[model samples]
Target: MTANSQMVTIKGTRDGLTLRLNDQCSFDSILEELYDKLSVNGVDDGQPMIRVTIQLGKRYLTMDQKEMLKRIIREKQKLVVEHIESDVITKEEAFAWKENSEITPIVRTIRSGQLIEVKGDLLLLGDVNPGGKVIATGNIFIIGHLRGIAHAGFDGNEEAVISASYMKPNQLRIAGQLSRAPDQDAEGVYIECGFIDKQDDAIRISPLQDVLKQKPDLVSFERRMLNG
Candidate 1:
């Protein structure tokens, strides 16, 4: 009836016992609290230990205490099987979504030879110099400068975009097409430097002023792209 460590709550169920641990606490504390609950219940002498399973959000973690603790640390992982079929999404399902999902806004610039792989839209505040590469499955945004190279739609997403404050990059790739910086404009926001047409395979760099006049909503790129 009583919770231990004021961090985990233990309750007796009709089948056995249930232990609910806070998400912020480490796995070690959870295990120690669980063991204490077992000792207090006095189920070791004659009675069997409760058939315990951990429920984290929507997924159920069913394993021995030791293995369960290990899995708890890496709870964000998803597992996939080619043949197995089931209706209910297990921790394996949540894990799959996490693995396949896109990461958002890269706040820092990648150094030389550093490879950054993100799932969702990515944004960089600093510059990406030569030899640095950024590969994102979704849109790529740069606030400062871009001089190295960046690849968007890495996983074959065609509707991806690459934007930067200073768009003088050595190379850029979107979906299946690639482009380099033009020998022209060097000031102001450049939003028209991507592969425009599906065919003919050409990269065009245009001024954002003309596009802004036509589509006013699209001009608010920062408000829409950045989550916070």
Candidate 2:
């Protein structure tokens, strides 16, 4: 007979083991079950340690829960343990962290003549007023309207890109490439500009006639300094 604490189903597979827990069961109980189960099956069947996948319900786990899981893993394996979700930062928090990444997002508005420099990608959720400037070593993104100057890939990342909700700008620069906004079509309701292949290295800024392009390959930004 199983312990009367909580209900947990364990299924052994060729690859590893999967543990499914009921919503009614607390995570502590599930941890107890895991410790019990793994204790019986030590990593010595000419077989490696059984990889365990916990099935957490719809509830969002707290940091404490995540720490507990990490502790368990570290105990089983004497080596350093790393968790996948530990580095996942939201777009807002990411702005402070992206100076060292291949790409980063600022996610904040910039006032006029404000000189902002980033080592990686930059993202802004609000508008960038005239005279304000944004420079990055990587890509740049303005989710809202952009009226100031924006420079991306400052470190010579030619593949970098710059995007904005309303893409009208006084000037745009990417790597060594630069372009100015055209006289006509100054305000037709849409605007976008980015580097395209071929001889069109110009910063193409125009009203977006079609749906705004989506960027999925964007990577997370890392911080150079740590704050408590």
Candidate 3:
């Protein structure tokens, strides 16, 4: 019910937030505005508040287009697409697709000067040496050492996570918050994760095992044998 550029209407639903896109505006612009709005709209800390349902009243959307829309909202806004009340897809089917969504994986060592960017979740199979960098819109999992820079939730999504077997990164960023690694002896380091805390508006790091206690599915790192 707004102008062409900002035609996306947002409302709260019983399940989560619901959005209605203006048919007159192009989907691309509508989605961009959606991302901007979610970033501005605050989410209560320590709550699973990012699930969203989209209502495309009377609009005929193709399966591909619908999936693209869902992915955009999920990755850019760090929300889950629980439903899309459109002409084509069923509610049950949509939820199942989300569960079956496959994350993108980069199976290689990130050496100096190398940069990798991923749309959804990213899986790094090897070490991130000095001068290397990795950016992802979703969670970033490093099966080996992370000595360089790694940014999870490259977009404005705050619930993203960054975890590694040996978390010794030079710099770490999640969404908009940034922080540097502490000067700790390498031997003292263990599996660690970086995330935005609900209690405070700051980025914090803790033992990955401790993180797993609360959010078990947050990190899924399959350890790989490393050389000294």
Q: State which candidate has the highest lDDT.
A: 3
lDDT of 2 at 225: 16
Q: Give stretches of model 2 more than 4 Å off.
A: 1-99, 102-107, 186-191, 206-228
Q: List ranges where model 3 is wrong by over 4 Å.
A: 1-101, 216-228
The lDDT values for all models are: 0.61, 0.63, 0.78
Candidate 1, residue 218: how far the Cα is off, in Å: 6.2
For residue 212, model 2's alpha carbon misses the true position, in angstroms, by 9.6
What total of clashing residue pairs does each candidate reach? 7, 11, 0
- After superposition, the stretches of candidate 1 with alpha carbons farther than 4 Å from their true spots are 1-103, 188-195, 199-201, 208-228
Question: Against the true structure, what is each candidate's TM-score?
Answer: 0.48, 0.45, 0.54
Question: How well is each residue in 1-228 modelled by candidate 1, as lDDT tens digits?
Answer: 334435567565775544455656665676676556444544333544334434443223344643655443223222111121223466776785555453465677777898887876676778888889988876677777778888887787665667777788889888777889888767665544343344555544455565345335444455654644
- Most TM-score-accurate candidate: 3
What's model 1's overall lDDT?
0.61
Expressed as tens digits, the lDDT of each residue in 101-131 for candidate 2 is: 6444466678886888977667677888888
Best first by lDDT, ranked: 3, 2, 1
